[model samples]
Target: MTGAWKKFSAQAGITMSEPVVEQMFGGERDPQRVADERRWFAHEMRASTYWQPDAAVLRAATPRIVVGIGGDSAGQLCDRTSRALAQSLGTEPTTFPGGHTGFVEIPDVFATHLRTVICEG
Candidate 1:
């Protein structure tokens, strides 16, 4: 049986890139398969999002903003933005770990490690 992904994408106006298609399905495939995988990829990445507070808000409120960076996947862009905000606002900077998915995958253990950083500072 055929699904309506192609029809829907065309109707709504969306273009799926090739690599995005491959990553979702786990390997190289024909065009129809690629298109289906693209649909899956869109669903997955959009489902989960990490929320960090606004840097501007942090800077305005805190006397000194201490940015706790949580590795690459931990929202380092936010860390960078926060650090930049801290620098602009004259605050302190800090870092921690679990890489990108560490916190979500291993919250208790990551928390224990993160505590060490906070305690030291």
Candidate 2:
């Protein structure tokens, strides 16, 4: 888990901190819980890697779709993907506060931004 955190921090161009990890996984960080989370993360990673979006369907739904990228996630994988998706849909990504885990890190601010995006959409 520590190694993963370090790798993710480096990739996201963020500093690694124990507090961030604790906040992310909850203070407990129980071995079993961590294992479960890791397994779920692995599954999600694999699923995302292979699941290709249908361009026709995406184009049809483009107007209704809103791509969002975190403010601090520039050059990160999620940021790149969001930008690519928005471009493919002929739109630009909406910038939200904080990094990839903004929703978790700053729920109030993130919620407000999300609401604005949805209302505007």
Candidate 3:
């Protein structure tokens, strides 16, 4: 799973430092933590497999839709998907600080930006 994380980070253009990797794994000595992370990944995979978005509902609510892409996530999966969604909605995505994990990495800045976006609407 750690290798999977590394591969995913690489594919996503995210450079994970040793400390960050360690933090993700909950320290080198914690096998349970690693297992927990693997379970989480599995759960996400399962959820994604079964999840489907209703295009009609999304189109109907386009005016209230606020597609946000991370500033540093250019060309990444989330960025591409967000752009596509915004395009389909006849709108543009708003850029936020950092990448996909921006909210977790820069909570304060992300929250502030989110608030501003919401207020502007």
Candidate 4:
């Protein structure tokens, strides 16, 4: 969890004190919504756990994965679950701007790296 917080701070260029909840959930926090989020987290965790044996996750044989992890609420990548997946893949995890969300915060940087990884890697 601490690592996740640090990751978020580094990627978003903000401190843990920042009130950026809206970045992920759009500031919605109703009871039903919280329950829904919990349910979805469990469901997604189950799904990601299933990928441990996946040929793809296991077959990063020589693949380079540029990780984009948002904050804790960014869903799968933004959680420790993705760290496990990354470890299973045996690749160095690189952080980019944004969390479970895409590179919307800094799309240009993401695009540059994406292109570099595609062409130069």
lDDT of 2 at 77: 78
| 1-121 per-residue lDDT for model 1 (tens digits) | 0234434434334344655434543444588866666775567434533444566776677454456555643334455555665576566655556544467867897788778865765
Q: Where does the lowest 10-residue lDDT sum fall in candidate 2? A: 7-16
lDDT of 3 at 28: 58
State candidate 2's TM-score. Answer: 0.74
Compose the digit string of candidate 4's lDDT tens values, residues 1-121. Answer: 3344455456534444434544544454577876776675557646754654563745555665544454433434345656665666665555554554446766787677667666856
lDDT of 2 at 120: 86
14-98 in candidate 2: lDDT tens per residue? 6657777668655557798788769856777568756767756988964688888999888887898789888888888899998
- Top model by TM-score, which number? 3
What TM-score does candidate 4 get on C-alpha atoms?
A: 0.43
- TM-score for each model: 0.38, 0.74, 0.75, 0.43
Ordered by TM-score, highest first, the candidates read 3, 2, 4, 1
State the lDDT at 51 in candidate 2. 75
If both were scored by TM-score, which would come out higher, candidate 1 or candidate 4?
4
lDDT by residue for model 3 over 1-118, one digit each (tens)? 6677877778666787977876774345567776776886777755864565776689797478888999988988678778987887788899999888799889999999999999
